[model samples]
Target: MTKHRIYTTSFASVYPHYIAKAEKKGRTKAEVDQIIRWLTGYNQMELEAQLKKQTDFETFFAQAPQPNPSRASIKGVICGVRVEEIKEPTMREIRYLDKLIDELAKGRAMEKILRE
Candidate 1:
């Protein structure tokens, strides 16, 4: 399957329409995406049709099944992180790492963290 890259600017442009569709169908954006992927295989028009037909969250999220940990682990590794490390990694951990990387790029605070 092809990975869909949702850019901030593009998402912002269509944000209202997506929100309106979600609200009209009483589904979350994630639910809408899942339903679309299942019903239409990424065809925008078919996705719209599925969204229009959906009347509730349960129907939209019918694809929800707890993923097998091994499958999830394999997918996570494909994106460049170990399964255990990512399982509970917080927004703070991510942001802090980003910040640290930025600081290192500008030549600050590298020795302290590297020596730990």
Candidate 2:
């Protein structure tokens, strides 16, 4: 099977969709950024820099600060696939972000979404 395009997709291109999804459900951009930071360790300035550069998803995660260990505890279906069951490392990382965003859009409490 051919590889998916999302791995090479620019994070900048995808960022807006995530924001829109969350905002449509009453979540703020700041809240979206907060969960992203909790997952990737990027501060506001760093996230801005990445978006400004149009970094690809691979590079975005590669250069991210060490992910919170607790992220492994995130579990559930995203796009109809169970995130924890994903075997591909990159896809799993992508789904982790997807799951977090899903939680935010679903109005999950921040502390719980962050796995605190």
In TM-score terms, which candidate is top? Answer: 2
Q: Candidate 1: what lDDT?
A: 0.35
- Count of backbone clashes, every candidate in sequence: 0, 0
Off-target runs (Cα >4 Å) in candidate 2 are none
Model 2 whole-model lDDT (C-alpha atoms): 0.91
lDDT at 34, model 2: 90
Candidate 1's TM-score reads 0.22
State each model's CA lDDT, in order: 0.35, 0.91
> What stretches of model 1 exceed 4 Å from their correct place?
1-42, 63-116
TM-score, one value per model: 0.22, 0.95
Highest-scoring model, lDDT: 2
Query: Model 1 over residues 1-116: C-alpha lDDT tens digits?
Result: 43223211232334345445555645455543443343224355544554465423333223223322222222222125543455433322222223333333344443432322
